[model samples]
Target: MAEVNFCLGPHVGLRPAVPGIKRAPDPPESYSALELQVAEPPVQQLEVISGVESVQLPCRTTAELHDVVKVEWTDSGDRKVHVHSCVPEEPEDQNQVYRDRTEMREDPLRTGDLSLTLRFPTVRDNRTYTCSVYSRAGRPRVETRVELQVRAQQVEVDSGAESVQLPFETTADLPEDTLVVWWCDEPEPAKKVHEHGTESDQHEVYRGRTRMREDPLNTGIFTLTLNRPTVRDAGTYACRVYGAGLIFLREKTFQLTVKGVSVLLLCAPTAAAVSLNVSPNLQQFFSDDSVSLSCVVGAQAGGQAVKRTAGGQTDLCGSGFGTFDGSSCTVSGLSPSDSGVYWCEAACEQMSQQVNISVCPRNDFARCPFILEIPALPVTAGSEVTLRCRNKDGSTHAVYFFRNGVHIRDTTMQRVKVEEFSVSEVQQSDEGLYWCSTDLLGPSHRSWLSVRAPPAPPPPPSVSLVRLICLLVVVCLFCICTVLMVLMCCSRKTGNKSPVAMEMTQCFGEYDDIAAGISTEHDF
Candidate 1:
């Protein structure tokens, strides 16, 4: 079965089976200590996938709102989504498209939950919806805005996985004459991945590899399973549902990625002070493609020399590495040995930051019509990353980008060369199986982007408290020993002394005798 996820908070790591837009919680009631005054309402965004059945746009207030207040939800375009009041309900006031699809709780004003429930939401429903609470006297009281995004369904899988499920389900019973069709864009024309009725028209490559639920008509779970998927199987897949007389009901798009050898990369601090730029700035390239490398020095001096380190050897731009005019290095007919880190060195031994260029072993461009450009190494998080849907002949075509089986970006304006899609401030969620395509140029091979956290700094030197205590004990013992030795020496010197001159000891009477005894003991 196709997995469904609803995330209205912080998201990290892998993308869900289907990804939704970002959302934030409602702002707290700002008029808490005020005397029944309204607070400036802040806008919050909520994300939900259209195929995920339903979603909630939350709006709540702690203030004592009036019981007879009216609650209404409308889009930024002034389209009404829902309305409720103390008067008779007018369902006709809502937009025709949202007439039966929106819902609100009974006496929503009394409970202070003015949230709106949008069902079976699709791309057409993506908009900023405002929730307003009006006083009984037609004065504004509390207003909360919610921006809801309804994204397409997506699914991703490893190339060697046993099976992958593409989800499509609904609560409303489909018409008895409903027809389901599944197709993927691959091999020049669209590949017929599966159909509900018959297997005779199935493609040879997908004959025994596709299946669906048996009681799809009754259960409404029409998820498709592709068995033993391969790398070439990565592309955009669509599931179309039809009603009686072949009337189109709905269509869901899936960006499927059969990941091959994945690249996990992390960047390091710049070795030098120069910046390296690659023309057409692709992360990965096939062997024998021409590339222009420029080492830009912030100082911008005219006579500075540029250098590169690749294939285990450092080559000065003026040498066989490429034609170099001090600042730029242009290499034609790149090879596997040319895949290495490139950087610039200054006259005073300062090194600039290095850039890595990865060259895949297989030249799928030599066989296929196009190949996606990606880094062979893991990308450092928060850096800009560019993905190019490069044609074999470098002709410009309408290029599309898909991450983990979901369409993300497309360059349709061919007025200029728009085959490249650059992702700025790359995040971990942006990491996935990415492939590109064009109307004339065939689909590019899938490239898995891996965003890695920066390497942690080395810990400071540790001092041991136990060792410190031991040193203190040793110092005290040494001081005590020195004091005792001095005392003992003084006592021994007095003990070894002759009391006094025997003649003087006589002390010429009784006074002399007491003085002699005291002098022997006290050693004065």
Candidate 2:
């Protein structure tokens, strides 16, 4: 058994520190009845700036050990910061405050790198963290401690305010020669907002705009005051304190944002360069058609993020039938199920205006009476078309109509049983997005009206010029033959009329009449 001896006098009640152990160490390895020495674990100091994404509490070992059980990390308040078990089947029992924000190495036992990273670290995480390693026998085998100090804050204000205050205070008693400076990252190079030391070079813009409550930041109350705040002053401002010889003591970072002019595109109308447009951009489309929607973010330098919410399910642009590229998403072979609301998110944390896309079901509205009855097919020009606006229930209010999002007509001045109305001999110009509504049902779903061109009239048929000439030639030959035969008989016997010319004109007229009949029959 090892005999534990305490140092006499002042060190009697102190911790486990090796006897005669100083800056140099060549202590005996094994402890028996003879005198022995055991080294004390050192505490590492970590100075982290707040407002950063995260900070790491490092604990590592190079010595070889065996039968590892678990590694636990706890804060000064005895709250569990992180825990990793060697056994793979156990569930994590982390606190709710640090549930999804803590992460550790996968295999701490093998690699001996038991480091805990705290995400979105704030001033609340500033404390001492103890890392303890246990063996398979449920005994602590190794221990180490770390002290973390987080520095920063966040401030938000509205534009046109008289003055804004970046508050910073410390309970630690600072030196008289301490220098405090508030730096802003909003400008090109880092600019000093307020300096409380000897005269130094200051930016021209903030010369008369900044001041401090104290003359020299004597007791570490280094708060800054800026006059006439504007949208250009929105950025990170850090208050850094320095002691004698310019030694850094503490720091607090502030994310200062002035609203009104510096707001996101989601709600503001000042973003004139950005545009969102849709192809075949009508309010509705027939089923089986393809829809292409695109957004141009011009100078806004954020990655593209487009989302569609349809049928109570939200999906990104790259899933299902939608395909995404730089700033656009395309969905082809659309159906009624593809109808939804879509919007895009810019990298500046700004969101574009939402768009509603409707993939019409080609007149399959047998289920609900809450839609405007549109023509299933295109109506011909100069043809009467009937539109029936369905309602959840009937009403006596006059039906009002809208075409292409504009009020164009109305009907039913008296009490009408039917909630629908019709239009007669609709011109081609009347075809557009149409909707009907009454005082009770509000308005029905919008539908598009299409007009087709009217058919041309038939022309009268005429006889062919070549056929008429042929008929005349054949008639002349027949008449000449008959006349020659008659003249021969007259010479042989007695006859008095002009036999050749007698029936010539009459033969021509008769043939012309017959030709007209033949042509007419062929045409029919």
Candidate 3:
């Protein structure tokens, strides 16, 4: 029964039930307001799938087109993708021509995942390629780009006069259709003295000095060696290739220099014998008359002396008298003019010695004479001749005497006293030559003396008168006798001498008295 029961004053008690919407349970307190939280997928990373970082290839090769190509692709997005294909094609979509020959494969794309696979590989297929992928979540498609290269074997050389090294490398991915050509630059003007590769292939200068280093198979490196280097082998060398209607080349250059070796000389003194000292008291001579000189070497070993001349050429003068061991020499003849420059020289092994000579004159008593003066003396019989002798300057103490040139005695007496040297009792034997000499220690002169007799009184005038008278008488007689003899001789011969005889007889008596007068005078 639907009985209405009055409950609390608000309404009668009648419950309506619903199956799904019974007043929804009050929302939980924790979720009273809207709070949205979104979840994100892991970010993708980029990676390298190709082995090469960068590449250089010959332009002449076409064979790269079909070579088994390797391509790399990476996922760098916030989501995963499934790779569909990596396609290689010409820039103008020319890949269509080789569609049937193309092949590709890829690895699953996860976070940081990258991978590659070969297409239908052949050398002729070398070209740029592309990688494509799609996301499973209906995301945008992902794609990556790649380049295919074609290459020929390349070699480069650096040549020096002494040696050469050829640098070479091969590409594993080179197209089968590529064509390679080997070449070298034009050689210099120098003669080919050496060859590295072979006489017909590679050559260098300096004969018989070539050496080469080549790896087994000659794939990567080749070098040429030489013994001696020269200036001629400097230039550029190259390797070239021709294919695909194009030319490719590689080259290198070398520089060089050369060197050599040399010698020199030197010299010393100007003149010959050099003067050193002057003797006989040089100082006593004037400056113009004094002397001195010396000799020396201007340069030591490896040198020569200068030639000197006074009027004409002369031999080189050396100190033959005072040479010491041939190294040092001295000379002792000096003149006032010799006081100038002088020099001496030694062998290459010895050093040079030089000196200047100075000459001054001095007064030397030991070399010159000292003179003395003597006074004259007068003496009579039994008297002495005292001769005073002294030096010119009167400074000398000791005195000496000489007779003629002979030495007599030496004394300190200034005045010579002699009591004897006279004729005693007036004897005639005492008269002779005599002289006095004085000593001045050197040369001395002598004084001369002459002895004479006193004159006799004139004959008495009275005696003279008588003698005169008698002399007259004798003269007359002598004349008479002479006449007589003459007359007698004439009478005997021819009786014609009367006048002559008379004259003779007249002179005879006078002649007799004249003879007696002469006898009387002799006696007197």
Candidate 4:
């Protein structure tokens, strides 16, 4: 018999089973069995084995055995197994599966011996069994569970086969809340392949390739139909059952060996090499740039394309923002979210090649006015100049100034707020192409500036030699007029005397001195 465990609570430890001593039935010469009261939903047992001639289902009671008014037994499928009725005073209504296959121990009614003996048990009889005991009057009903398992089995299947089914199954009359799970036994913790419940987390590898049979409980077919079985599918398959309260009723494992070619060859081409390439070998793509990805197969055709985004999920190549042909894929208006790895899968080949892609958003500097203004161009070397940045539309966009294509300063402004970047003591290095832009998205108008040394000073004001000569001539003429006037006055005063004439002559001679003196004065 397989080991069975009972769970009372998740945090609590397991409850050990009470050992029961073997005993013979009463009136050994003439065997008799009683019908046990069946629970609305059948109760499950802990353990049972196939190929057993007889097995004892033990039940314990705290009250006296004689005081027990009635005891009942039911199979995992809610099938009537046996009933011992003290009120009716008889055993009846034994299910056909166990009609003459059941017996009671001696003094059961007197000793409260609620144990059941199942005769000639086989694989078909392997299941959960419930035993319920009811006392006289106001006593509540007591229920216990027992689960049974058959020996391990092995099954074989063909690789690349359309479908493979596991033969394990449960009876049709299961409770509405029955849950079943099929999983791989090895690779410990068991990889789940399929499940039937409110929630299930099936393994990714088995997704879309595995499913459970329809109406499993009613058809007693717990088989899992795996579509397109591969060699990796060959492993031990386990099926576990749960009752209404999510109680673990039973579980069984079967070794599955897939026969045929290796799964690797089936899933992929032999010695096939595929490559992924992007046109223009773009490391960064603008938002509106069109992108095309080509799968270059080495002497092969029918390559399948796939893509993975930043989230590390593999999806069809053109599923999102692209259209994929057999050999290539194209995407337009690539955004930041489109950055990830792109994969190319060659037809009939398990191998794939991937290339990383990056996308960037386009900047629109054209949206805002971008102008660079130099206060004065061809400016002096030692002059302070301001480069005024302005936008005609008066937007508060961030402005970046660049000199000869190199960024100089970045600033933000409000409406009509000019970015006055001053250059102190302008130098040769400051003479270059200067441009301002709202952002890197668009182009900006550039202007050049030239720096040079300061100009020479003008000569001081002075009089010419010609102008001095002209002034001297004018002074001589004025002196001559004054002398003539004085001579005229003397002639009028003294008339025609020889002595006067002689005196005049002397006077004239003296006058020569005076003229000489005047000339001397003029010279001074």
What overall lDDT goes with each candidate model? Answer: 0.65, 0.64, 0.32, 0.60
Q: Output the number of the TM-score-best candidate.
A: 1
Query: Sorted by TM-score, highest first, which candidate order results?
Result: 1, 4, 2, 3
Q: Evaluate residue 246 in candidate 4 and report its C-alpha lDDT on the 0 to 100 scale.
A: 69
User: TM-score for every candidate vs. truth?
Assistant: 0.37, 0.28, 0.18, 0.32
Q: Candidate 4 at 142: error in angstroms?
A: 31
- How many residue pairs clash in each candidate at the backbone level? 10, 3, 70, 29
Off by over 4 Å in 2: 1-151, 186-188, 197-199, 261-524
- Which RMSD values do the candidates have, in order? 21.8, 31.5, 56.8, 34.7
The CA lDDT at 203 in model 3 is 25
State which candidate has the highest lDDT.
1
Kindly list the per-residue Cα lDDT of model 2 for residues 450-523, writing each as its tens digit: 67678777778777999999999999999999999989987966655566566887898999999999999999
Q: What is the lDDT of residue 88 in candidate 1?
A: 49
Model 4 lowest lDDT segment of ten: 4-13
In the predicted model 2, the residue pairs found to clash are 50-151, 152-253, 302-347
lDDT of 4 at 144: 66
RMSD of candidate 3 to true structure, Å: 56.8
lDDT-better candidate, 2 vs 3: 2
